[model samples]
Target: MATFSSVGVGTGGLDSAALIKKMVDLEREPLAKLETQKAIVTTKISAFGQMKSLVSALSDAASKLTSVTGWNAVSTNSSDSKYVSATAVGGTLPTTFSVAVQSLAKAQSTASAALMPLGAAVGAGTVRLEVGRWSGTPESFTPGAGKAPVDIEVSASDKLSDIASKINGSGAGVTASILSDASGERLLLRSKVTGEEAGFRLSVMEGGDTDIGSAANTDASGLSRLVNGSTVTQSAADAKATVNGIAVSSGTNSFANTVSGVTFTAVQVTASPVEISVAKDTSAVSSNIDAFVSAYNAINQLINEATKFDTTTGKGALLQGDSTTIALQSALRSAVQSVTTGSSVFQRLADVGITQQRGGDLAVDKTKLAKAMNDNMEELKNMFRSTEGGSAEGIAVKIKATTTSLLSGDGFFKSKDNSLQLALKRNEADRVRGEARVDAFEKRLNARYSALDTQMSKLTALNAYVAQQVTTWNKSSG
Candidate 1:
């Protein structure tokens, strides 16, 4: 009655263990099918995630076209860019103007008397720098309004190089450096920006004992030399120019507000007036159109690939024959082709040179598009942009509406994804129950087979004993 590890060890080698194994495997067929279905659902859900992202991108591109402000970009042309260069933005009316550059703004620069000896101590004290305007031959400084002096303290052992480092790190609105020459190194100070207000003035806040001066703030000794002994190399001045025959002055060379919505930078004084023209920027319109087309094409390509089927290989894509995806493809194409009477200018995409091709992708006719934009820009703007007075929705508006629905709370993506998740849950539940049932079945088969082996073993022993007794009786009778 001893049990053997091998399943086919008893029952006259009937191999009941192998038979049980085959039956158990056959029972798992349904669960295997469930597993395959679960895999398919999972892959389809992942594919939809990709589709939703592309649709969102298309929506973003469409949203940009819905705004009227984005279309107000203008192309500004200057007759002489060498003298004047300009740019236009933000609802600037198309107009031509004349500009004459008389002078370019300059920054004030100053130098101190050379402190002889290469490594001479420049005296210890605080160097106070002020941003202001300077005038007169001897130089009288007026600090700019609301400006505060930035102080840089010096140590007794500090050389001109150390003091220069401290000044440069002080954020004093002026750059400082040591200029080495035959006499020695001198402190050079220059305004960081070109403007009358950017001019800088230096004075020592007398402190550490070294070279004391009669006039601590102005005398030519110690750090005071940076002020009293300094001479102006250049004077601060505003850019002098005239726009449309009216003279205008700017602290900097660039004038942004002289002309409404038009900014021009004076590069140099011109011999004659520079003519400036503001025109509609057709290139920006073209770029927006191209972006929309590209975004739409991306969605189209994704749908095509996701639902594609290969007949030769007997294989289909993850979302092959999906109704939701197919409907989306048709709806988008219909939106592009639909005509809306709300727009008074362009009723259809084709009117703006946007044509749908045979492969369901949009193509742009650049020459035709340019002509349409040049001929009637307002109408073109009305085509894609939403306006007041409640006209019919534009093409972009229509497409964006569709995308919003698909990505919304009760949208197709959410609904479809939720369904797939439920299917996965059901698949797991079925797998767990089916495995448990098969396991119990295998255990039952084992128990029954084990009992059969014990019975067969006992019968074999009885047969052997009976045969021996029969042989001994026959021999005795003989």
Candidate 2:
């Protein structure tokens, strides 16, 4: 039988195939490791991006703290902050200064002359106002030419609330409403149709029209005005309600006469004091700064993870000593160091106890911070909120403008993240491209092994056939 070589013929041929196979097999581990590395890098990049966002939020919050006078976030546990003068706190008293009134634009009591007026007297029935033409006869109601009331049927599933929605949605020339008071809830209907004839007529079909009283129809058991106690009917749009001889407007009335020049709007009729106190919100400003500091710390913690070097693990930080991170750190440090000139407030980080330590880490001076918070509150507020001309308008506005320019799409954070993402992507792509080369190598190796198998099988068959033929020839010659 023909023998096969234990080792392939040439070192550069089958030997190279085995070497390539070994190399390909070895590549699987590193490729997997590279994939893991890519994941880690992606995670770091994403975390940094999140850190950027959080820092931006923190900075914004801080800016708000610095600029806004009364905008503060108090802890739920803090009792110094109070909701004192609001509704529930002083229920019987006029504690709240805020006022919101129902819109009266839809409260139409009169219309121009195009509508048909109801006749002298009527009683119990469903008042279905059918649109029609005017016939001089009081009972002869004819459909108006080129005019029709939209046909709308209110279902049992629909409540009084749904009626308004239905009429408004049906392209109808009317609106439905419910007028609520101490008496009860009354269904009110008005016309969306403008001008004199926009108002529709009402004719009861089921229940008695006892509640259908209007300025136009009062003789039919319905009152033009619901008389109750000393209450009076108002007809004009500009009418004001009086309170102990004080002229209070009906719609969102503001009184600048009270609270030492403080304008307060009357919301409801109450026997309470109409006084609201406005003071310098010092605690609020402090709490806001504290919250901003907390947020900044949270972001700082995340960034620290990426930049930290672990001495115990003997492993480098995920983004350890990254130039971009270093640059950002430096920029932050410099930005914090930059002082606002000609300000009466604590303009520099040192004034607020934020300083760099010997270990290159940030240190806080609690006492200094407290003092700065207390002593230079207004100054700090100005430093944060002061405009280019040192005028205090909106603190958040100025801070947002500055920070947005630093962290926006074309800003430092964006530019750095984008560059890092591209670098990571390129590294991952290169790694994947390198790993794909192994597939071709693996295929070539398999092909070589298959050719070797076929050649060995053919040689064995030829050797067996030759050996059999030789034995037969020897036997015949003997």
Candidate 3:
């Protein structure tokens, strides 16, 4: 009789489960290769996305330089900024002027006589508030037109704090507060706006039931003390100034449209006139040019690195053999190098101190650019933003248009990305099918091995029984 030990449920003593796994792995090798290829495509798509973003940034920078307003910005300077400050718009002709700030506008305020306590009750009354201008030595009051007076009613039981709250919530363009001194607490009121016309006059008439004072009393001891006559603390006044020695009056300190395309704001009164000058801001134009150059160079650098091939390492970038990236780089370079035919002095970017480097990046010559901007500003502006559209369009405009077309929905990069995404989907589907086949093969191998193991065990059992019976017969015969 012969006996066999179980080795992975196989009659031949082989590990069938391990062998089946090895076979399945061999069969799925192609699927693994597909996964690797999908990874490569995904990386290439990411590289293209980054390149598109750089190109878009460059386009935005170029678009800013395509307008005269973008380059012709101006700045105003005041010799004594403590007295006045000014701002100017683009294309404002350079000029110098003398300015003197005489006085700033003021708001009117009034306060009542000292009362006993903040919560003490005062006489009941209806106080009518009106916003108007005051003039003349005796101060003749005329109510403002188109502005209806606001009236607030007070009761005999209402405290000073309650009266203040009622006046504040009445929308009378006056704010009320309780002020305290060594004598006692008093109610103070102030106009919301500045200048003479913003002044407010209060007229109070006593109610039938009174608490602190007589109903007909018009003296300081009565509720009528909050009026403008004896309670006036500060008078309202308008701002006065002089520009180029000419007197100028304004209701407010901030003066817009004082000079053409200029705004002047008075800070403080000045004893002598301050010099305010508006000039052509060449530095601003230079800064814009530098920004454009930097943005263009950024895109150029990205394209260069993404498309380069290294012969020494036998390695290449993700976009090395990509036709779309090659075409994009060529188009961007051509747009930057194109010349404007209509411009007289400045026809190309090189004419205005922007020149291409050996590596396709743009370089700016600050001194040369400043000279060009000063000598031929109109021609310089036209070179970058020509209104006569077509092949004669400016370089900035051409570059902007090229980038816009490339980044559109059906653009080159988008189409390439879509194709890669489709390939990834196909790869995933193939992998899934391969995995299913492997699983089915593994199940079949396990079932066959288990049946064979049962048959081998039965044979061994029968052989052992037969050997025992033969031994017993041999002993009987002996």
> Which candidate's TM-score is highest?
3
lDDT of 3 by residue, 264-349 (tens): 88999999998989998878777777888888888788878988899999998777887877888899899889988757788888
lDDT-best of 2 and 3 = 3
Q: Which sections of candidate 1 miss by over 4 Å?
A: 1-7, 11-21, 79-83, 98-103, 116-121, 157-162, 179-183, 208-214, 242-247, 268-275, 304-317, 353-360, 363-371, 389-391, 428-478
Give the 10-residue window scoring lowest on summed lDDT in candidate 2: 225-234
Range of the 10 consecutive residues with the lowest summed lDDT in candidate 1: 1-10
Ranked candidates (lDDT, high to low):
1, 3, 2
Residues forming the 10-long window of minimal summed lDDT in candidate 3: 1-10
lDDT per model vs. reference: 0.83, 0.50, 0.80
- Cα lDDT, model 1, residue 476: 100
Query: Could you tell me every candidate's TM-score relative to the true structure?
Result: 0.82, 0.57, 0.85
lDDT score, residue 350, model 3? 82
Model 3, position 442: C-alpha lDDT score: 61
**Taking the tens digit of each residue's C-alpha lDDT, what string does model 1 give over 36-88?**
99888888888889888988999888887887756887889999899999998
Give me the overall lDDT of model 1: 0.83
